[model samples]
Target: MMKNRRFSIFIVIILCMVSFSDLKAQAPANDKASVKTFVQHFYDWYNVLQADDDFTRKHHLSPFAFAIKERGNYFDKPLRQAISDYFHKPLKSGETGLDFDPIAAAQDTRSGFQTGNVKQVGNTFRINLHDLPKGKSEKEILAAETFLVVVAVKVGKDWKLANFIYPAKGNMSQTDLIKLLAHQKKFGY
Candidate 1:
């Protein structure tokens, strides 16, 4: 009787361990889906603001205005602080601090955008944002311009924007939000 009881207990313990191991293995997949969803929601909100004539006309706000206003909801502390400081700082004579929208990576907003491949490395995620051309099929979005790459990191219970990776433009090399902010200050731009 005693032997049987001990064996039963051992089997239960083994089963519990296996269950937990499986959950651990699946955590990354679940997290990846979550990260992808979070980015999609952000772009959805951003694009709506961009297309809203009343919102833009009434407030005279840029598309990034929402992100800046509710930064704490979208950005982690480090990234939030960097962007806030850069925008709020007074410019020197002849200094034009970032002329383009860093998040959109363009001077003019497109009619729409689509989220593309989302790749995760460790806790960081690189989510592709592609410009969706008018009258184009969903298949064509893959070939469309990759305007921005959002870098997101898990912050506490939620994912937060860490940086933005913009593609190379004419005369301007590929750059990120952190690097651009630092460069502007370093070169007195």
Candidate 2:
């Protein structure tokens, strides 16, 4: 009877270990889903900016300032400030500006659907968005455009957007763009 009880206890321990390992294995998948959702929300916000009037656009983008102010790192503060100024100030006629494009950035080159993968680099994750193919549904097209890359850093268990790069002129990463922006004192100190 004693032997049987010990064996039963051992089996239960082994089963618990296996279950925990399985949960651990699923963690990556959950993380990916979360990252994808974050990007999608950003895309949705960008779309609203594109469609809305200047006054409405500023109101829409104002919330992101809170996110940047609250969670952004040292480098991200200037970027956030620049974004805030852009929306708050009046637009100049025929002035071209940079913004995240969801369609061109997230579309799969072959599939014409939004597709991307998260690559872990040190403590950061680089989300590389693919280009959509020639033909696709309007809904899919509206879902994403010109957003090329997004950099995320893990804060506790949650991933926060550190920076994002748009494929304008050429493929420029956020790190590169921020470096350039830092030099321009007009944007922020």
TM-score of each: 0.76, 0.45
Model 1 lDDT tens row, 1-189: 999999999999999999988765443667777887898788777777777758666777666765688656788788787777787778999998888877777777766767777887656888888888445665787777788888988877899989999878778788899998888767765
- Top lDDT model: 1
Off by over 4 Å in 1: 1-27, 53-57, 133-138, 169-171
- Which ten residues in a row are the worst by lDDT in model 1? 22-31
Across 1-189, the per-residue lDDT of candidate 2 in tens digits comes to: 999999999999999999988765443646666776676565444444333346235555433443444334422444556545544655456643434332233222223324366666655566765445435554665466535667766566665666665556556434434443344335433
In angstroms, how far off is 187's CA in candidate 2?
9.9
Clashing pairs in 1: none
What does the lDDT come to for candidate 2?
0.52
lDDT of 1: 0.78
Worst ten in a row by lDDT for model 2 = 101-110
